[model samples]
Target chain A: MNSFFQYFADIFNGVKSLLTGMKVTGRYFFSPWEIVTQQYPENRKTLKMYDRFKGEVIMPHTANNEHRCTGCGICETNCPNGSIEIIQDKIDMPDGKKKRIIDKHIYHLSMCTFCGLCIKTCPSDALAWGQEFEHAVFDRTKLTKILNKPGSSILKDISE
Target chain B: MKEVINLPVKNIEEEEYHINMGPQHPSTHGVLRLVVSLQGEIVKSLKPHCGYIHRGIEKMCEKDTYPQIIHLTDRMDYLSAHINNHAVCLLVEKALEVEVPERVKYIRTIVDELNRIASHQLWWCSFGMDMGGLTCFFYGLRDREKILDIFEESFGSRLLHSYYTPGGLMMDIHPDFQKNVKVFIKYFRKKIKDYDDLLSGNVIMQLRTKGVGVISKEDAISFGMTGPTGRGSGFSCDVRKHHPYGVYEKVQFNEIVRTEGDTLARYLNRMDEMRESMNIIEQLIDNIPAGDYTAKMKAVIKLPAGEYFQRVESARGELGVYVVSDGNKTPFRMKFRTPSFSNLSTLDYVSRGCKIADLVAIGASMDYVIPDIDR
Candidate 1:
């Protein structure tokens, strides 16, 4: 007789619990403004990323079209994926002593993992994170960037 | 002529057939294939196939420096990104015998709790979807985004943040980080009730989960399961309680346990765990001491020739990182004893004699990440 009563009580309790669950979802259905999803691409103009957001690596050029990279190759060694390559050429200095100058700082965007090791390890603070992230290209070769701009030179006061 | 047909007497026997579930199916979560042998609807035996996403992270660690390895751990157990990074940081700190600042300790603990909640939230969303309740996915993901926003403002990435370093954090917390976390805590506490109403209280959910896929306490220990999956069996294996690290010892919170050891019990354990995580974060977030975010260290970190191991309680389980240094910048040998691998090994043991449908609930309850197992 006790077990018979317990079975009915269990059914009653289960029904009550299920009803309570329906109440929460029913309330959400009426409140359209509470929906959290944003139309992603449509809101692209108004979308804002955080200030410290890391997008990609960039080397800032001065007004004279010169950068701070000294062809030290620290970033090249620090990169875990071998995404950076330093091409160096010898130039006759004003004092007639041959010195190594950076010919090109090749950055392979396709291979980059954005680990930030290369930028962090730059002793001269030559490299930094850029905010631009829209980096799609038709050709794979277009992604390999020469960070040293054409007709641009390294800073005159190059130090080892 | 009645030629005696060379056929033996016909016999009836129940023959078992096999079915494969995912290397692509949505319910398995990530590329984990299960070969389930069955007699009609009942499962006779089960086998799991892993290693689809193995990227040789441990091998790569041998070539990269200590700081670089922190990035790789972000991929393994990606949901518990902060905790995984913390494990590597702790290993490096111990090898160097460096004492991190009190501020760093407090901040790390608070962030770790927030990380735990986010991971549990994602698991809850997918677990609901696995049970054929699609609405729970939207609700769980909506709340989880708030925590990701806090991480993004401070840590600079949503899914993967290699923020923690050996001596300290990569950068200081954002100025608004405290205010945002406090607001989120207040909001989430109220919604946790709705979570119960929307799914936990539902009769269908209860019927589907309650008293399903039970793992015994002795079996849990033998399988070497840790974290909530083991705790559900009343194993008392909460790593945070047993082995306190960071500022965990200073905090007060219950290590939730359930003796039923069933699917429902494991589900309830994670739900209660999210609340405990909130309690832990509240205790530490307000009292973060003022000190250096990073310590003074050499440009290159070279450890002495020795093998060192450090373990931390991740959202999934206890993650142990072992490093063998040969007095070099990079480790000579690196190994990770991830929790999901052991938890996954017990699946075949528990699923035998149950219906093939029940295996889905059982697998969902274990909450094993595929990459973590393969790694």
Candidate 2:
């Protein structure tokens, strides 16, 4: 007789627990304004990534067509994935000494792991993380980019 | 044709069959295949077949510098990415004898706890969804996003944050980091009650989990289970409590343990662990010191010739990093004693004789991340 009563008690407890759980979902059901999801594609116009987002490596070129990189190739050596390639050419300086100048700073987006090592270890603050994250391209060759603007030269007082 | 063709008699109870659970099943959660042998609906034995997602991270570590290895560690156990980075950082720091700033220690500890909460939140939701309750999936992710936002503002990546370098953090905490963390703590404290009401007290959840996947305390220790899985069996193996790396030594919190040694106990252990993590964060958030984020170190980090081991309590379990340095820029041989592989070994032991349907629940309760296992 006692076991029979206990069986019914267990069922009652189960149903009560189910009701309590439903109360949580029910509260959210009535309040439709409490939704937390942001429609991704629809909200793209208003979307802004955080300032510190490690999107991609970019060499900032000034309006005067000058960059900070001195062709030291520190970033090239520090990059774990061999994504950065620094080609150098010797130029006759005003002091009659041949100084190495950067011909092209090539960056391969496909090979870059976004680890920020190249940016952090750059000696002259040459590399910075760009805010642009949409790197998808239909062709693979498009990912290999020359970071320095066309015909850009080194900054005058930039330290190596 | 009555030619003495005698057929062997089949035993009624000896029927056993095998089925592959997944390399792609959602319940397995990340490309883990289990070969389950069954007699009727009862699981006779279980075998986990890993290496579907192995990336050879340990091999990659040999070629990379110590600072570069932090990124590789993040890829292993991506849920507890911060703690994984912390393990490698601590290993290098101990070997180099670099005393990181107090600020760095406080920030690392707080971020570690936040990562713990996020991991446990994901685990709880996934565990709940695996057990047929879908609401937990929404609630858990809803809260987890807040922590990710904090991470993004400070560390620049939502997941796979290589924030900790060898000697100290890669950068100082963002100006709003403390304020944002406090807001999250206050907000989550209220929501955790809802977690209990929605799932903890639910009789159906208890019925499915209680007394399932029972592992003895001795068996748990023998199997080398750590973190919440071992804590569920009352095998007090929290590396934070025992070893106390970072600023964990200064913090006050209880190491939650349960003696039930079952699926429900493991489930509850993580649930309580989330609360304990909050307690840890609340204790340290207001008292962070003003100092340098990193220590003064050379441009290149090369540990002296020796072997160094450092362990930290990750969201899953104890993540130990072993580095053998022969006085080089990179490690001679790097070994990671990840927790998931050991925890997965016990699945076959605990799930034997359980219904095959319960195997999903058992596996979920263990919370073994597969990439950590393969790595």
Candidate 3:
């Protein structure tokens, strides 16, 4: 007789427990304000990434088109993957000495792992993480970018 | 026989059959393939075949510098990425004999506990889903997002942040880190009670998990199971408790253990652990000291010629990092004694007599992240 009562008690307890679980779901169901999902494309206009988001690498040039990179190639060496290549050209200085200048600072976005090693190890703080995350392109060649603006020269005070 | 008639006899009930559970199955989580032999519905034996997602991380470590190896460790156990990175950082610090600042120690411990809670949250949701409760998935991820936001706001990347360097943190945490974490702790505390209601006390969850996939304490130790899986079997194997590192010694938190050694016990252990993690975070968040985030070190780090081993209690289990350095920038050989590899070894032993459906629950309870196993 006790076994029969215990069986019924078990069923009753199980149903009650399940209902307790459902109560949570039901509460959230009725409350639309509790929703946490952000409609991605719809809210793109107002979306802002965090200040420290490691989106991609970029070389910041001053308004005068002078960059801090001296073509030392420390970033190229520090990068785990061969993503950065600094093309150098020798220029005859006014003092009759040949000085090496950066012709093009090529950055391969496809090969970059976004590890931030290049930026961390940069002595001159030449490289910075850009907020532009949309790197998708139809052609693979588009990912290979020249970081320095056209005909940009090195910052005068930064050069030793 | 009396009519001298020949008849084909088949003993289907006694016959054992085999079925492949994974390599693509949802329940397997990642690329883990389990060849399970069954006699009808009951699983006779299970053989977990790993290496499907192996990226040759160990071999890759041989060539990469110590700093470069930090990112690779993130891929091993992506769920416990912080803890994995912590293990390597601890190992390197021990070798280099650099005393990290008190601030760094406090922050590392707080972040490690936070990572543990996030990992448990993910496990809880997936475990529920494995048991056919889809709602748990959404609830778990929803709460987990709060923790990921904390990681992203400070560490930059959400999933695989190699935030910990050898000497200390990659950079000092964001100004709002402490405030944000405190808010999350307060918010999650109220919601955790809901977790108990939704899954822990549910009759179906109890019925499906209790007395299932049981492993004795002795068997658990023998199988080299650590973390919550071993704790479920009443094994006091928390690396944080036994061999405390960083600021873990200063903090106070109980190592949750259960003697039941069953799926329910493991589930409960992780649930209790999440609460403990919040307690840990609460203890350190307010008392974070003012000091340099990183210790002064040379640009190039070279460990003296020797073999070194360091173990840390990750979200899953004790993650052991063994390194042999020939006094170079790169390690001569690196071997990771990952928790999931040893934990997965015991699957066939524990789930022998369980129903095939119960296998999913057992695997979920074990919480063996596949990349950790393969790596």
Candidate 4:
């Protein structure tokens, strides 16, 4: 008779515990304000990314297309996967000095890990994180970006 | 053959049956294949075959610089990314003998606890889903998103934020980092209580988990299971309390341990850990010292020719990173003792004699990330 009473007590406890659990979920179901899901694509216009976000690397150009890169290749050396290829011209300047200038700073976005190592190691501050993060592409070759614009030359050293 | 000429075998089948449960299955979490042998509804034996998602992380670590290795560690245990990053950073700091600023130490400890809670939130959400509780998936993700937002506002990435670096952090905390964290702590405290009411008290959850996947403390230690899985078996293996690093020595929090050695005990230990993590965060978030985020170091980092190992108490368990430096910018050999690998090894031992449905509860209680096991 005592064992039968214990069995009923166990049943009551289990049912009570289950009902208590249902109460929490039921409360959330009624309170729609607790929902936190963002509808993607529909809310794309309102989406905001933080400033410190590590996006694709880009080289900013002045009005005259003057860039800060000097073909020093510190970023290329710093990259773990060798994603950056710094092509040089080695121009003989008007002052009878052969100086290395960046011809094309090829950045393989496909191979990039977006670790910000290349941007941080650039001595001339040539590279920075671009705000644009939509990187889907059809052609694999499109990922290789040339930092220097067409007909763009390195800014002549005014300090010298 | 003479005895069973007319009728087939009553219990044992003539053919050895085998079924694969992963490498792509939803319940496995990642690409983990479990070769399960079933005798009717009961799981006779289960063998976990890993290495489907292995990207050769340890091999890649050999060619990368000290700072570059942080990016790779994020891929190993993506949920506990911050804790994984912290392990490598701590090892590099110890090998180099670099003194990180007090501010960095305090911020790192707070961020690690935050990451711990977030990892547990994801585990709790998915564990419920694995046990057929669909409502829990939403509730767990809902609370976890708040923590992910805190990560995004500060580290700029939600899942794999390579935030922590050797000697300090990758960058200083955001202007509103402290305020945002404090607000999250207060809000989560109220919501965390609902977890107990929602699932802990649920009869179905109790029936599914209680007294399932029982492992003794000796067995837990022998299997090298750490984290809540070990703690559930009454094995005191919390690395934070044993080997205090960063600002853990300064904070006050209890290491939760359960003696039941059952599935529910492991699940409850993680729930209790979230409370302790919050307590640790609250204690240190107010006292963030104003100083340099990173210490001044040489342009190129080269460790002395020696072996250095550092273990961190991640959300899962003790994540030990071993680096053998040959006085070069890159490490000579790198090995990671991930918690998931050891924790998953105990699956076969505990899952035997349990039903097929109980296997899910046992695996969920272990909380082994497949990629971490593969790595």
Candidate 5:
């Protein structure tokens, strides 16, 4: 008689635990407001991230078309993936001496991990993050960009 | 005379046996090896051996560029890749003295939360499998896949996305990401019931898990267990709530806790945490502040020489990255205080004298991923 009562008590406890768990889940299921989910793309205008969140590398161009990049190759040397490459040209100086001029600063957006090593390694304050995040393109070649456009003069203040 | 001779029988003595439970056991969850000494069914002693998956991440950081090292961080805790990326980004941003945009911070918070949910989902699935419930593993993975789908859309990689950079995120949230996340949460919230029905209230599961592997609150603190492991033991140490990085300060969510400090308590705490993460995601989806995702900073970022330590609440626990910079692109010395390392160390203390089957329960309660511990 005692063993039978023990079996019945065990069944009662099991049922009680089951119902208690169902109640907890049931509360979350019924309340739509309690569901914390965001629909993206269709809601791009509402999407938010932190202001200082690091995304990609970009160079800020001034209204005068002056850029701070001096072709120092600090960013190139510091890049872990070899994503940034700098090509230099020797320009004839007024004193009949040739000075090393930055011909190209190639940035491979495809290979870039966005680790910010190159940016952090730059001695010159020329490299800055541009806010354009939509860099997706059909041609992979488009991703390897020259931060400083050809014939664009270096910013005078960037040298210091 | 024959009966008297038959009565002279000898007794057999039980032998102490040593069972090595991995560097490669399916239930060890990584490359963790536990040398378990047992006499019959009860474990006499357990010694946890680590360093199997250690790639020497700290040593590797010295050779790789700051950006290159971010890839290394991805391999440390492969499950919560974004959180690791976020830690690296936060440290570099602090060192560089760069200001990130408001929009980027909000996005970071959302992604971080999403990653947390995904990591916990994997944890639940694996924990269930460890405890002898195979169905729960499938259920947990089914939900985890939805989150992985969202990650694939935005970052172009599911498991190891090097998405978070120093100044902001790698790309804008994918056009369909918001809708997918919403659907995922709705489906997952309903699925939680199915999980509870399948495993939580099972008599054998409850009997095996509850009141087993109990750790006192003081021991939990002394051992430095974090995330759900410590939270199960009633420690309120969530970096998201305490430090309030990115947009976590603005979003509302509760830090899930349980007072029992037992295996069942840890399991329940993780279940509650998954729901809380879903709550935070729901609140922020509609209100994501719009602006430039990346801040306008110099093309080249240079940091002044100083040591910086940034802590983020990873899915596992408090992930602290300590970086010393010598005004160079490469970090002078980088140290990562991974939560799994401390959490894994507590297993020996907790598993003593328990049955061999209960050792898996105790190890599962710790919720350790081997790479996280080894790295």
Candidate 6:
């Protein structure tokens, strides 16, 4: 008789525990207020990120077809991944003063770890985040971008 | 069929059987090797061997700049990469005396909480698998995927997101991050019941966990366990609550703790902690303060000569970082006091005399991530 009672008591305790757990879960299940969960891609219309959120690096260009980068190569030196490369040229000015110009500012996205070391090390605050995260391409080489515009010289205001 | 007995039999004496437990076993949770001496089915002694996955992260940090070293931290505790990044960033920010914006602090707190939830979810799933319940693994992963989706949408990467930076975050919070997080909390809040019904209340689970791997509060303190491991043993050691870094000071949430330092108590403590993290997230997500995310600092961030130590409550335990700056762009020496290393040390004391099968249960209860241990 004692053994039978023990079995029933054990079953009763098991059921009680299960019911108690279900009650806690049921409370949340019926609640009107839900926590944050946004479906991506489909919810692109409602998707939002920080404006200054660091995603990718880009060079700033002035309206006069000039850029702020002046072949200083500070970013290239600071980059741990060797993602940034700079090529400089000597420009002969009409005023008889030769100026160092950035011929090419190559940024290899493939090798870049996006540590933002390059942007932080820039003496000229000319490099900034472009907010372009969808940079996936068919070929790895396509990720390597040249930041300097063709036939463009350093901005006179920044260089001075 | 009976084989013929050996003609010459020597006098038998007492001998012990030594079994190597890992460096490759699933229950070890990374490349942790344990040498166990057994007397029949009972374990007599156990020795833990480490350093299989050590990548010399301290040496690697010397070669990289302040910003580049953040990536190295991501590899230390992959589950709580954001928190590790936060620790490094806080150290650098302190060295430079840069004050983070209120908005940035709030955003960092939210991301850290989300990462905490994801880490706990993975721990729950992996722990379940270690104990032979495969169903709980799927349930935990299913819930964890929701948190990962939010991270991927806000930050470009899912796991090793080097998002936190010195002055503030790498960028501002995603526009819809608040709303998305709210939805996730609501869904997760409801899903906790399913987890309880499936695993917590199960008779088999209770039998395996409830009274096993018991540790006293005094013993826990002596062993230096933190987070849920310490909390479950009745120690109130939560960095968010104690130190209150970022915006955690503004948020209201209970620090889940249990007096019983048993495997069940630890499991229950984490479950309650997950709920508390959700509670904190619910209150802060909608009311984020508006301000600049990044504080203005010099382009080349050079730290002053000083020693700074910052501690954060990672999902595993207390993750303390000690950094020495020699007024250079990079730290002179960076040392990490990882919780897994200390927590893993307690396993031998707990596992002795227990059945070999119970070793897995004790290990799973400790929540030892081997890479964190090895690093």
Query: Which pairs clash (backbone N, Cα, C closer than 3 Å) in model 1?
Result: none
Candidate 4: tens digits of C-alpha lDDT, residues A106-145: 9999998877777777777888877677889899899888
Docking class of 3: high
The DockQ for candidate 4, computed on C-alphas, is 0.70
lDDT of each residue in B1-375, candidate 6, tens digit only: 999888976433245788899889998878899999887777778999989999988877877778788888888899999999999888888777788888888888889989999998988898889878776676788789888777877775678888887787776667778888888898888888788876788776788888788888888899998989989889989888989888888888888889888899999988888888888888888778888888987666777888899888888989999988897887888899999988887888887778888888888888887778877
The segments of candidate 3 whose C-alpha lies over 4 angstroms from its true place after superposition are: B1-11
Give one digit per residue, the lDDT tens place, for model 1 in B1-375: 888778765432377788899899888999999998988888889889988988999999999998888889998999998899999998888889899999889889999999999999998898888888898898999999999999989977788888888899888999999999999999999999988887888778888888888899999999988888999999998889998999889999999999999999899999999999999988888899999998776789999999999899998888999988999999999999999998999999999988877888888888878999998
Q: List the DockQ of the predictions in order.
A: 0.67, 0.80, 0.81, 0.70, 0.11, 0.20
Which docking band does candidate 5 fall into?
Answer: incorrect
Tell me the deviation in Å of residue B268 in model 3.
Answer: 0.4
Tell me the spans in candidate 6 whose CA falls farther than 4 Å from its real position. A1-4, A11-71, A87-112, A119-160, B1-14
Summarize candidate 2's per-residue lDDT along B192-270 as a digit string, tens digits. Answer: 9989989999998899899999999999999999999999999999898888888888988999999999999999999
Compose the digit string of candidate 3's lDDT tens values, residues A51-102.
9988888889999999999888988887877899999989999999999888
List, in the given order, the native-contact fraction of each candidate.
0.67, 0.78, 0.78, 0.71, 0.16, 0.18
The candidates, ranked best first by lDDT, are: 3, 2, 1, 4, 6, 5
The numbered model that scores best in lDDT is 3
**Candidates by DockQ, descending order:** 3, 2, 4, 1, 6, 5
TM-score of chain A of each: 0.85, 0.92, 0.95, 0.87, 0.80, 0.81
Candidate 4 local lDDT, B1-375, one digit each (tens): 557457554655534467898878777887889999987767889988887888999999999999899889998999999999999999988888999999999988999999999999999998889988888888888888888888887887788888887888777899988899889999999998888888887888898898999999999999999998899999999999999999898888999999999999999999999999999999998899999999877788999999889999988998999988899999999999999999998999999989888987888888988779988
lDDT tens readout by residue for model 5, A12-99 = 9888876765565566579868544567668778765434334567777788887878887777776776888889978887889877
Ranking by TM-score: 3, 2, 4, 1, 6, 5
How would the docking of model 6 be graded? incorrect
Q: Provide the TM-score of chain B versus the true chain B for each model in turn.
A: 0.96, 0.96, 0.97, 0.96, 0.94, 0.95
- lDDT of candidate 1 at residue A15, scale 0 to 100: 85
How high is the lDDT of residue B137 in model 5? Answer: 72
On TM-score, the stronger of 2 and 6 is 2
Task: Tell me each candidate's RMSD, in Å, in order.
Answer: 3.0, 2.6, 2.7, 3.1, 9.1, 5.4
Q: Say which prediction, candidate 2 or candidate 6, comes out ahead on DockQ.
A: 2
- The local distance difference test score of each candidate is 0.89, 0.92, 0.93, 0.88, 0.81, 0.83
Looking at candidate 3, what is the lDDT of residue B52? 94
